[model samples]
Target: MSTLEIRDLHVAVEDKEILRGVNLTVNSGQTHAIMGPNGSGKSTLAYAIAGHPKYTVTGGRVLLDGVDLLELSVDERARAGLFLAMQYPVEVPGVSVSNFLRSAVTAVRGEAPKLREFAKDLKNGMDALSIDPAFAQRNLNEGFSGGEKKRHEILQMELLNPKIAVLDETDSGLDVDALRVVSEGINRFRATGDTGVLLITHYTRILRYVKPDFVHVFAGGRIVEAGGPELADKLEAEGYEQYTKASA
Candidate 1:
């Protein structure tokens, strides 16, 4: 099975440290949820893994199935089977969603998908996400609502089929119905048994739907507590008060 290992990962943005010696592991077919208060470095871990230039890796190693991810560039990391669904998807006003997705697929696959097959796959993914067919012609995430952007992210995940998906607050801004739709799409992706998921969120609501195999409480830029799914239930009821207080 594919494996993503984070070893004492330390990340900083603009000379200020964010992720401080965080360590975790996710195996294919396993879903790990990271819950924490705002600015607790949950998203920082996601960006650092995706090789975001803004987040400097002060120290530590991120290995994906024995390859040192820190040695690869952002696009190279994508080709190496890493994907990140941003918390706030940016708008590309001139690039159509269809074109953008196709380009990304080509980059990751190292070959262009057959046009007919690509179209079919795109349509199927969109249909599964309940996205309108007309969205294909629209610029990527341009003029889309929060829920639509989030669904589009899942749609990309479905089509790209990365080995590891680092979803940063994907459930944010999604209404109940949208949350269900998005969660279902994630579930479908996980069913493939070849992809690992790192779900980062503040609330446990999404955990109810996605059902993480492991739950981690991120505080002070590191995991302070970890347990099974029941940990999520406890967090939902008690909140991050204890963890945050301890960190403080």
Candidate 2:
């Protein structure tokens, strides 16, 4: 179990400020939801935590279990047990999903999984998510449908089992059926009760499947409001309009 702490974070992309003095924390076994309209910097925070070069941290510190995260490179951060499930996962043309995951597991764990044992874990993860094993042989996220892409993200989350998982708009393009599958995968990630989750989304539908311990409303690059589960209900009923007006 690990703790992800963001304190007074200020992030900018290409000299344009995105996140302004944002502060949030996700402790082990907890889930925090960041909800905001488009362009509110939710994804910016995600990228910054993953140490994406494009989003520069103009101020503040990101601590993974009290260790400085901003100092490490992207790969080093992943190796330190921080995983970001991108809203749009990249398509690697020549790499199969299995091979990609295998390399990732090896990189993060610092050792390769035994061939037979690794195969068993892969099969179990896919079966748990109802993904066909054949999909493993296909290129990473190439030619995959929207649901498949999201499922592939979940597959990575399962295989990696990072101490903290940051999922950015994972439910964006999924239908109801796909939503169920993706939601189930999220629930599975919580089975260990030690993997923290920072789920960023615009809609409350996904929250119906996975309850959040804290709900935060982001507007204009800062967290404006935060509350318990009912905060999601209020947002659903009254909409971000109220929060937007208030924040304005």
Candidate 3:
């Protein structure tokens, strides 16, 4: 069975319909890229799946490994092996990165990890992201640069090791080097387990580093096209204009 499935999903924010109806399935050990122009509801899908209170599910269901995710609370969903890395991660002042990640790790594992082991793992994750070990001591995402915030998100993904992770605009503000680092971190997370990935982005830069197993084009709040890797290449060459016009 697919690790994550969105069946006829519908969502809205403040009664303004965003995701009209969407469907996608992600199996283990595969990466699926959702590409589209701005305002195509790509971010809305991610937020709705993650149970953002602002984005209400108006219809359909989201399943994780055949379990109805809609029945679970936000934290329950995370504990059930679902993770969403936001396009704009919030900054938590007064919360050290180490403390925040440790808490998350504890919550996901249902027990506190040994301090030594947790520290070691944190250091390793930071190293993988090319982040300095000192970063763990700073406030979570507070005062962090755009690239740093993205890297921090990947770090949490590595430490949590969720079954399916939805990365929203993960490469939005990254430089070449930082993009490579973030991509490597994602690859490493998948390597640890047969993690399924749903990557949402408007650009194709990160796709070059992390090859996608499937590509879905989003337009007008729905998936207009689904294909193999070549779909991404086609989008890069011809742009989303053709798809947008066709969908319109």
Candidate 4:
């Protein structure tokens, strides 16, 4: 089984401290949900884990199954079994989705996938996410709708099958039906029992479809409360007022 442990994570952006001594752990077959108000460092934790150059890790240790992830570059971290589904997927104007996915797979696997097998896997992943087959030929996220972009992110997750997935507000900008489709795609990934999911979001709606094993409330750059599934329900009804006040 794989494990992702964040020990006393401290992050800064533009010389301003954001994450102040945060810690969490996720094991394979488990899903952890982070809910918090805006500017509470939820997305910062995601970007920090994925090695985004914009978010500087002032202090912390991010480990994947006991391996120090801080020592690796972004691409190296991906090869080491870490994946991030960005909230805003960038537009790759010249690269086809099929080509981008294949290249990414090759990089992570350290070898090219056979053409036939790769085509089959791509088709299956797209079909599972309710994405049209023709999307493979289009430039990555170029002119794609918000729902389409989110679906594509999950498609990558399905194909990559990384040890840990840090999804930043994946449910954002998705309509009701699109949200269901995306949530189902995530559920499928969770069923593998091989990928640990760190789902960061502000609302509890997605939590209904993608149940979390643990729920953490983030405020003032750190987790102020931790609980189980019930915590989500509480957040839905009571909101983050209490947590925000506590953090203040």
TM-score of each: 0.99, 0.98, 0.97, 0.99
What is the C-alpha local distance difference test score of each model? 0.95, 0.92, 0.92, 0.95
How much does candidate 1 score in TM-score?
A: 0.99
User: lDDT tens string, model 2, 58-126?
Assistant: 999999999899999999999899999989988999999899999999998899999899999999988
Which lDDT tens digits does candidate 3 get at residues 155-197?
Answer: 9999998999999999998999999999999888777658899
Which ten-residue region of model 1 has the weakest summed lDDT?
44-53
For model 1 the local lDDT of residue 218 reads: 100
lDDT of 4 by residue, 1-248 (tens): 99999999999999999999999999999999999999899999999998899999999899999999988999999999999999999998999998899999999999999999999999989888899999999999999999999999999998999999999999998899999999999999999988899999999999989999999999999989999999999999999999888888
Output the lDDT of residue 45, model 2.
Answer: 90
Kindly provide the TM-score of model 2 when superposed on the true structure, using C-alpha atoms.
0.98
In model 1, what lDDT does residue 194 have? 86
